[model samples]
Target: MRLLITGGAGFIGANFVHSSVRVHPEDSLTVLDAMTYAGSRESLAAVENDIRLVQGDITDAELANKLVAESDAVVHFAAETHVDNALADPEPFLRANVIGTFTVLEAVRAHGVRLHHVSTDEVYGDLELGNARRFTESTPYNPSSPYSSTKAASDMLVRAWVRSYGVRATISNCSNNYGPYQHVEKFIPRQITNVLTGRRPKLYGSGTNVRDWIHVDDHNSAVRRILADGQIGRTYLIGAEEERDNLSVMRAILRLMDRDPDDFDHVADRAGHDLRYAIDPSALYDELGWAPKHTDFEDGLRATIDWYRDNETWWGPLKDATEAKYEGRGQ
Candidate 1:
C-alpha cells in the first residue's frame, strides 16, 4: 500500500515510518512535514531511503489533495503539540491542528482514501487524581489547553466528515508517548536530557499530576492495526495502562541515570494543568486484539535513556535552545 503520513518527521510519526518500513516491506510511504522546531529530518535518517520526504505543510490544500489523491491511505499526525507553546501562543496550534486537519479531511474525502487521525488523551481533559474512571471512547470532550482544544476540533471534523461525506477515517486518541527521537521539550526527554547534561530534573507544582504513558512503538503498532482493520468513524483509546505521577517519573529517571532521586527542583506548574489523564484501552484490545508490547515503564525508560545517551549528536544541538525556552518562561 502507498501511504501519505503528515508530520512524518516528528517523534511518533517518525517511529511509525521506521516501524512500517521494517515490518511491511511491501508498503511505500510519502512523508509530509513542515519540519517545525519539533520535527527533525535526523529522526527519519534511518528510513530515508525507504520513504519519500516532502517538506510541506498539512494545511496546504493543494498539496494535501495531490498527495492524498495518489495514496492508498493517509495518516494525519501534523500538529503543534506542545501545551506550553499553546498556552503562550495558540494561533499556530489553531492553524496546524484545526485548519490542517480540515485540509487533510477534504483531500481524503475528495480522493476517497482511508485516513487515520492521530490525537491525544488530553482532549478529554483531566480526571480526578484518584478516580477509578478512565477515558473511554464515549468520554466527553473537555479540553483545557489550546493544543488539546484544537485537537478536539480536528477530531470533530473527522467525525462530521465521516457522517456527512462518508469519508473513510479512523481516530486514535493516545496517551503520552515516550521513545527515541522525541524532542527534548517533552516531559520524559526533558528530564532525561537534563540528567545527561548534568542538570537536575525539574518537576511542576507538587508533582502529583499523573499521566498515562505508552511507548511510541506500541502506539504505532496500534495505529497500524487500526488502519488495517478498524471500523470507519470509530475512535480508539490507545494506552499501556501504565500510569505514573510526574514526581515518580522524575525520580525513576534519576535513579536509572544513577543520580539521587531527590535531586530535582520544583518549578511553577503549567496553567490550567490537568490533574490526571488515564486511558482505558479495553475496546482496542477486545475489539482489535491490540496490546502494548512495552508494558514495563522502567524498561522502556531505560531503553529511551540509552538511545538519548548514545545518540548525543542527534539531541545535543536542540538541548540548549529547549532549556533556554523553559528558563525564559521561569518554568
Candidate 2:
C-alpha cells in the first residue's frame, strides 16, 4: 500500500509518518508538505530519503492531483493550523484549509484513491450546557473561530465528494495532540523549554480553557485503522478522553520538570477562544474496536518532556522565536 500524507513535515503528521513507516515496512509513503515555518524538516529527518517528499502548496491543483494519482490513499493534513494565525489573516486559512481540501478532493475523485480527512474537535464549538456530552460524530459543527470554520468547511466538502462521486472517505476529528517533534511555539513544548532554560511560560487569560489531549502515536493508530477498515462516509472521533484545563496541564508539565509554578506569565485572553472542546470516542471504540492505548496523561507527559530534554538541538532554535513572536499554538 502507498499513502500520501499532506503536512507530513509538521508535528503530528510527521510522527504519524514515522510511526506508520516503522509499523508497515511493506507500505510505501509519500509526504507532500509546503515546509512552512511550523512545518519543520527536522521532524521528518529520519524518513526524508526513505519516503518521497514533495514540497508544494496544496492549493496548487496540478501538484495535488499528481501526488494523489500516485498514492493508494490520501490523508489530508495540510492547513494553516493555529487559531491566532487564522484570526490574524483568514485568507491563508481559507485558501489552504478550504480550497486546498477541494483540490485534494478533486484529485482523489480523478485518481480513484481513498481519503481520510484529518479534522479537529474544535469544529464543534463550546458546549456550555448539560453534562457536556463529548462531541461525537453526530455533533453538529458550530465553529467559533476562523481556524475551525475553515476546517468545518473542508469537512463538509469531503462529505460532498463522498455523496457526489461515490468516493470512499472517512473523517477523524481528534483532540489536541501533545508529543515529540512539536515546535516550541506550541503550549506543551513551549512551557517545558521555557522553564528548562529560565524563561517564563506565557499563557493567555485565566488559563481555564479545557481540552482533551492524545498522544501522537495513539492518533496515528486511529488513522491507520480508519484507512484499513472504516466504512465510507463514516466520521470517527479519535481522542484519549484525557481532559485537562490549560492551567492544570501546564502545572503537570512543571511537575514533570521539577520546576516552580511561578515561572510563568499570564496575559489577556485571545479573541473568540472557546472555553472547552471535549469529544466522546465511544462510537469509534464500539464500531472500530479501537480504544486509546496510552490514556495516562502523567506518563504521556513524562515521555514527551523527556523527548524535548534529550533532543535539545532539534527544538533549541525555536525557543527564542517562540518568545519573540509572543505566539503559542495550543489550549
Candidate 3:
C-alpha cells in the first residue's frame, strides 16, 4: 500500500516512518513535513533512503491534494504540539492543528483516500481525583489548554468529514509517549536530560498531575495495527494502562539516573494545568487485539536514560537549545 505520513520527521512521526519501512517493506511510505524545529530531520536519518520525504506544510491545499491523491492512506501526525508554546501563542496552533487538519481532510476527501489521525488524550482534559472517566471512543471532549482545545477542534473536523463527506477515517488518541528521539521540551526528555547533566528537574505545581504513560514503540505498534485492521470512522484510545502522577514519573527518571530525589525542582503550576488524564484502551484491545508490550515504567525509564546518554549528538542540539531558552536567549 502507498502511504503518506504528514509530519514524519517529528518524534513519533519519525518513529512511525522507521517502523513502517522495516515492517512493511513492500509498502511505499512518503513523508511530508515543513522541517520545523520540533520536526527534526535527523530522526529519519537512519531510514532516509528507505522512504520518500516531501518537505512541505499540510496547510498548503495544493500540496496536500497532490500527496493524498497518490496514496491509499494518509496518517496525519503533523501539528503544533507544545502546550506551553500554544499557551504563549495560539495562532500557529490554529494554522497547524486546525487549518492543517481541515486541509488534510479536504485533500483526502478529494482523493477518496483513507485517513488515520494521531491525537492526544489531552483533548479530554483533566480527570477528577478517584473518578473513573477513561476516555472512550464516545467520550465528550472538554479541552482545558490551548493545545488541547485546538486538537479537540481538529478531532471534530475529522469526524465531520467522516460523517458528512463519507471520507474513510480512523482516529487514535494516545496517552503520554516517551522514548528515543523525542524533542527535549517534552516532560520525559526534559527530566532525563536535566538530571543526567546534574541539573535540577523542573516539576510543575506539586507534580501530582496524572498521565497515562506509554512507550513510543508500543504506541507505534498500536497505530500500525489500527491502520492495518481498524474499522473506519472509529476513534481508538491506545493506552498502556499505566497511570502515574507527574512527580512519580520524575522520581522514576531520577532513580533511573541514580540521582537524588531532591534534584526535582518544584515550580509554580502553569495556567489551566490538568490534574489528571487516564485512558481505557479496552476498545482497541478487544476489537483489534492490540495490547501494549513494553517494560514496566522503571524498566522503560532505564532503557530510555541509556539511549539519551549514548545518543548525545542526536539530542544534544535540542537539549542545548532548551537550556539556552531557560537562560533567556532565544525567543
Q: How do the residues 1-331 of candidate 2 rate in per-residue lDDT, one tens digit apiece?
A: 9899999998888998899889988888999999888888888898777788889999899998888988999988888888876877899899989999999999999998999999999999986633567788888899999999999999999999999998889999999999999888777888889877887777888888888899989998999998898999989999999888899988888877887765677876889878887889998888889988888899999999999989999988877876766645342
TM-score of each: 0.99, 0.96, 0.96
- Which parts of model 2 are misplaced by more than 4 Å? 327-331
Ranking by lDDT: 1, 3, 2
The per-prediction CA RMSD against the true structure, in angstroms, equals: 0.6, 2.0, 1.8
TM-score of model 1 (CA atoms): 0.99
Position 181, candidate 2: lDDT = 92
Task: Say which candidate scores most in TM-score.
Answer: 1
Model 1 alpha-carbon miss at residue 331, Å: 1.3
Per-residue lDDT of candidate 3, residues 246-331 (tens digit): 88888888777877765777776777888888999999999999888885888887888999999888887778778776545222
Query: How many steric clashes between backbone atoms does each model show?
Result: 0, 0, 0
**Model 3 bad stretches (over 4 Å):** 327-331
